[model samples]
Target: MNEIESYIPHFIVHGRSRIAQCECASCRAQTPFVTNAWSNQVRHSAQIQCDSVSREVLFERDAFKLHTQPSSPGDGEPLSAWQNNVNQSCINFLIVEDLSIEERLHATGVLLSRLSRDDLNESDASTPQSIGDELLTLAVSGVIRQRFSQMPSIDRYKRDYLRRLAKVHLRVTPDPIASLAFNLKLTELQVMSDGFLEDVLREIESSRQVEAFFGKHGHVWTNYFLHRCFHDVFPGAARNAYDVMFLDLCLDLFCLRSLCAFLADSDVELTEESVSALFSAWHRGGKECLGRDDHVDPLLVGYSLITRKDDRYGGCHER
Candidate 1:
């Protein structure tokens, strides 16, 4: 096995002798990697506890390291050690702890009622307004803030988008839904947190103004990109929750490209100092800033990905 594939032992259980099915049209049509016993073990481990067995198989650490989570919300780590770091106070301050059902209902009601304004269109009813004031109360009642915050980019994109949704409605409710969420029982709460994000993204995209706004914003246009990424390339029940996130990143690059285009030809001119400050402010939030900011390019490292490969920023530099 190659070094990278070997590192991801979950995919290649044994060295090479593990049996695998190639029934998937794509897999059958292309070169296949063998799945080892460890893949099954990891799968089994996920059924019970996520980190312990996966760690044992990969030999990263005895305790969990909380690697990248595909659908993870803010503050959910596999290993407690990797969690509880203090770099995120600003974000956390904005993030409220999980509240009881009553709190969630209260918050949801506030958000919904605020969004229900005289300015809304018929389409808003299905999306921004569909989330009834009642559901917020329900969300708060059983919510527990997810445990780890350093999630994979894919998951973070989804969370940031949701957080933005909450923030937009925060005007409606003052207190937002949050960029973070309670670690709810997956068996039940997944429909509320994860499902809700998916639904809102869809409804917004379907609206006439939203579609036009997206068109004007170009790629990486928040709701516009999200709607296309999820519905077009990666639809519901993607390979995993993270799959949705992955496609979002792909679209994010399109966003970066769009940003380059916008800045290169903007009528609004800022001094180089302003550009530099915007860059630094954006980088301070680290990667989280990329997915959320419409004004900032997601390519903060001054790098770009070409052909699924990491390529440093390929755009022309100003003289």
Candidate 2:
């Protein structure tokens, strides 16, 4: 093993590793170097958690540092402080938190909604709406930058197109939904704090404009999948759950489209048949592609076998 991989031993115990608690002098000296190197190494890769075991240790140290530091100076304005910190560390925030893109956006929106309730002077430039818009813009750009950080210039053309498409679909196409969501949130009529039932209810009971938009787009595959998976479990009065499900599917499709475009540009031949077969396996089995030490799905194994032989695609490993 290399010097970097050797550090993994210090954090491993009984075949499990925990990065948050390692504080040896050797770790203090070498952890940052390892993480920085691993960060570049893992960019745009789809390896499982085991592959990242060593890197996670390093990342946890950095996150611990960030967590210990005050989010902002002593201004005592939480929203303004978050705006400054997010503007400066948007990509880092996503990485350190290990949140999916959707989760990060939702979390940011929730924080914005809660913080916006604070009274602000009229002269303040960081109005709730302005700060929220800026935060959203930063979030999108940060994801794009991190996701495509290692792609070639040729593939980057597709990445740039995706960036624009994401901007339009996320920011423009969903305006009515955003407006309705904002109004519903202002009402604070939540039925439950932890479950998505209340959120589904929000979409179903929204205004006619929102209802019409969801109704028009309700025939998507995501709606079908959610219906198949969830209808029986929550059978009664859940007819309108498609309103929320299809919106989720729309966002997922955008991610899939972006992935396909990049892979195609990288000379990974993709046909309708192959794509269908891939998703078919995921549909029949499951889509939880996360890493396990003893087993990996055949789909990922095959893809990795093909990509690992060539340096063109980003990191893929042989188990």
Candidate 3:
């Protein structure tokens, strides 16, 4: 019989080895023997678990084996079938937390392989939107918890996967803007007392420390912070006049000129328009701003505005 097939369980009923021990120099190597025994114990436990899952036809042939089937072209299998197979495999392995790193990696590989560009895009479906989202959360929070417990730097692929997960979460949540705000570490104020906005405003008015902090990070962080504050006040409603005035005050404290620049460049146009027109434009623009890139650069906004202006004016310089 081969060495693997001839393997027997090691037991110590009363601290005795069943096998005969030859007192030679090699036999005296206690460390190696103990290490091998421990290694065998772990492997034996893993194999037993594998045996349980191996009864399933899908896993029986491929549990320990890497999937080498071509997903398209020469293979008759469609991409969706391959995706479903991979998703099922990942879900199964994810349920068993004690699986080896190889098994976890296999699950991760299959999950990643199943994703197409379409899976990353935002979807309005009531379902989870993307299987990759749940798989990623499970893999990180459950299967590989220990690996990321120390908070190591993630590689590019893992970072991209995390970004996709965040996008999906943002889309599915009741308050996507709030979801995004939390992800950006702007959630500190969520724990503050009932008079939170009052406290912030008072602090900003009373101290240079608050001003200095906002000055250092500039409008990118300021915009994010404002979004978090507004979302906390309004939850999901459109911003009203009070919201705009509060934003204007915060901007003015940061710098009056910056506030002026913001109003001028905004869609509201700051003209003698009716209150309804102004509020409508401001609210719509606020929603668009929340969904824009993190940084609030006037130059980039100006470029976009110029393109839009050209389209509206039909290339004519005159109004």
Candidate 4:
């Protein structure tokens, strides 16, 4: 075999081992701190024809650790036992008591805005819909609405309805040319940066060629787990499914993850309405001008989402 051909198997083994270590550490933490980071690692590993290690080993060790943690003296309960005591009904009540549907949609919109493409945001002043504007708007709305369906009071039937609605409008065919162009542009952008994220992005770029399997299996693997992991994060409905699927395709992008972190860490209010109005402007492809009332604060929907998840874990109660 030629030198390049001979090196392929070695590269595959290294990538697979890197992914396994990340996954094992994340699972053992008993929290989702590294969930987003390592998720794409698994898919990239799969793309290189690396076999998936047994995931049964991932969580069971954590479960054992849970029981070993000492009980608090004041309450006479295990420190982590609050999660077991909190029921679905209680979590729903705590989440909805201070927040209305409109507020939830607004927070969801903020998250959607953060997730939108840099290209789309840039074109808002020029030609918007010439790109994939409407597809993203609708997908954000659809995912939010689907998340609400999981609540105890909401009709669970909305899940299937929203899924169908998403599938009907979202026909995301593989776009090899567009994907290649994007990666090429991304390469130009990352090469100029100097930081840890730049290094990670470089590694991902080097592995892109092996991701022929991504085109075939990415939609299933990426979306299924994202939904499962973020099931409780946001709520609302947009007008299209293609937008949602398109965003899903871009989930592993470093810019998107950084934007999510930025928004979540900002000081925006959870019940802000102007955030939704700004999202509406973006949804309309930014053709219309924003009024004085259209101004939105920086978003903290990520913080809000994380707070809610923790609230559910610590025994749901009014904030």
User: Could you arrange the candidates by TM-score from highest to lowest?
Assistant: 4, 2, 1, 3
For candidate 4, the 10 contiguous residues with the lowest summed lDDT are 36-45
lDDT (CA) for every model shown?
0.26, 0.29, 0.27, 0.25
Of 1 and 4, which scores higher on TM-score? 4
In candidate 3, position 280 carries an lDDT of: 26
Q: Give me the runs in candidate 1 sitting further than 4 Å from their true place.
A: 1-77, 80-239, 267-319
Q: Work out the TM-score per prediction.
A: 0.18, 0.19, 0.17, 0.20
Clashing pairs in 4: 135-243, 136-243, 141-237, 141-238, 142-238, 144-236, 145-236, 170-242
In angstroms, give how far residue 205 of model 1 lies from its true place.
Answer: 25
Candidate 3 lDDT, tens digit per residue, 166-243?
Answer: 221111122455335433422333344435533432332344433342333232222222222222221112212222
Best candidate (score: TM-score) = 4
| Model 2 lDDT, full chain set | 0.29
Model 4 Cα displacement at 151 (Å)? 34
> Which stretch of 10 consecutive residues in model 3 shows the poorest summed lDDT?
45-54
What lDDT tens digits, residue by residue, belong to model 1 across residues 45-150? Answer: 1110111221122222111212221221222222121111111111121122433211221232233233434464533334332333234333334331121111
Better of 1 and 2 by lDDT: 2
